[model samples]
Target: MNASMGPTLQTQGFYDRSTGTVSYVVWDAATRAAAVIDPVLDFDSKSGHTATRSADGLLAFLHGKELRLAWILETHAHADHLSAARTLQERAGGRIAIGENIRQVQTTFKTLYNLGREFLPDGRQFDHLFADGESFILGDLEATAMLVPGHTPADMAYRIGDAVFVGDTLFMPDVGTARADFPGGDARTLYRSIRRLLDLPGATRMFVCHDYPPQGREPCWETTVREQRERNVHVHDGITEDAFVAMRTARDASLEAPSLILPSLQVNIRGGQLPEREANGVAYLRIPLNALRTVGSMPARHGSA
Candidate 1:
């Protein structure tokens, strides 16, 4: 614990090596109330199997710690891994929530997937939808949600005490930042969003949702505003918006789509609920052929995050 952050806030990260994603359990030590951020639902594409091992581990931790679940937060609808929000909620009660801009993402994918009218894009799927700058209480801590779209249109960062969970907005300084080539993504917009987080106090703790470490370095998720602003290769202190955009655009062009994009988005948009079962009782995921530009493309610069 950072002495400056007081004794209330505590955080533990769960890393999913399969997807290179990190899920966090942050709680108020005094109140024992907690929030689970970006939990992963284990998925095997080859066999079309889903498991709760990852999420169940988190639940076990919560139970062992005697912490009360308050919120299950998603930074955005992910493209790389399935969400465990609904699964976690079924086992442990919490308000499952995400940014309100998810409606836009829902609309875009609904058309691409040709989802039926049964699905609604009104953001009702989530227990709550947070607007930019919205404030909420987690135990005794006051947390604020900040919209940080770039990698995706609905990305949000949660600021609790002195720590911020930046979902895909910025990776570790060595890894730079997330790609901004997805639908509704803009390099200029991403650069501005990154600057917003960096503007926080230099000592602010920044937690990344994903980390793809380079060779010889182990995975790490925690960094500071000061570290990012000073060492981030893509957008360091002296990097201009134009220069960053140019670099991101070129870099994203050479990347391939995430392996689980099809299944991940379908389940994620529904607040982590699998697609409604068909008459046969098996839920199906749609894959639009030759639809996404990233299909059959060259290898990704950084593997899915």
Candidate 2:
């Protein structure tokens, strides 16, 4: 374990090759109080099958180390992978939590999916909702929530000790920042949020939720704030907010929707629980046909110039 002051902070990252996601387990050596950040449940979009293998690995680690699970923290509502937060809590025990702005995401998807009145947008799906700059405890480590929305309205970065779990906010310097075309996501807002994160003490360890590596490189999830500020393709030290927004918007226009966006959102908005089953005893995910517009985002409407 890496020692810091009286409490030692240690983190282990697990990469799921399928979605290129990196889930982390961060704990203190002096107390063994731990939290699982952005856990994933193995999902097969083709077969519609869900497995516990990925999360099980995390559980085994916690058990092996005799660590007490305190929080199952989600940085945001992901569009790429199914969340294993609920499953992890069930097996290992932790309070499921996410950014308070998840209500905005939940409300957006609830309308898109035409969910019944039973599904509330009150953020009740989670055990706790953290607001921006909220302070909390992780064993002996002090943590704070920094709302970094842009990829989505609810994205948050958790700062614990010298480490930060930045959920889809910023990526490895080469991979750049996350696309900010999702509903309720503004390129300008995201750029500002990212700049705020980069302004932190340079040596701060920034851990990303997903890593899309370049051809010559293997997946990497760790980068320092100093490195990101110096080399991040999307928003480095010299990149202005206006320029970043233009680049981000243009880039998002050319990108296709994530392969698992539909399935992931339906499940994730419910705090990783599948939609309630019908009388047939089966839970089903709804795919709203053409519900998401991706044909062309040309700002000029129709023939207007």
lDDT values for all models: 0.89, 0.85
- Model 2 CA lDDT for position 141: 86
Q: Give per-model TM-scores.
A: 0.95, 0.93
- What overall lDDT, based on C-alpha atoms, would model 1 receive against the true structure? 0.89
| Off by more than 4 A, model 2 | 1-7, 294-305
Clashes of 1: 0
Question: lDDT per residue, candidate 2, 1-305, as tens digits?
Answer: 11223237788888898888889999988789999999998999889888999999999989998999999999999888999998998888899999999999898888888888989998999999999999999988899999999888999999999888898988899989988878888889998899889889999988988888889998888889999999998788989888988898777767777788889988898888877778999888888887565322323211100
Check candidate 2 and list the clashing pairs: none
Shift of residue 53 alpha carbon in model 2, Å: 1.0
Per-prediction RMSD in angstroms? 2.7, 4.4
User: Which ranges in model 1 have alpha carbons more than 4 Å from their true place?
Assistant: 1-6, 293-305
Write the residue-wise lDDT of candidate 1 on 1-305 in tens digits: 11123468999888898998999999999899999999999999999999999999999999999999999999999989999999999999999999999999998888878888988999999999999999999999999999999888899999999899999999999999998878888889999999999999999999999988899988889999999999998998999999999998888887777888888998999999987788999988898875654322323444532
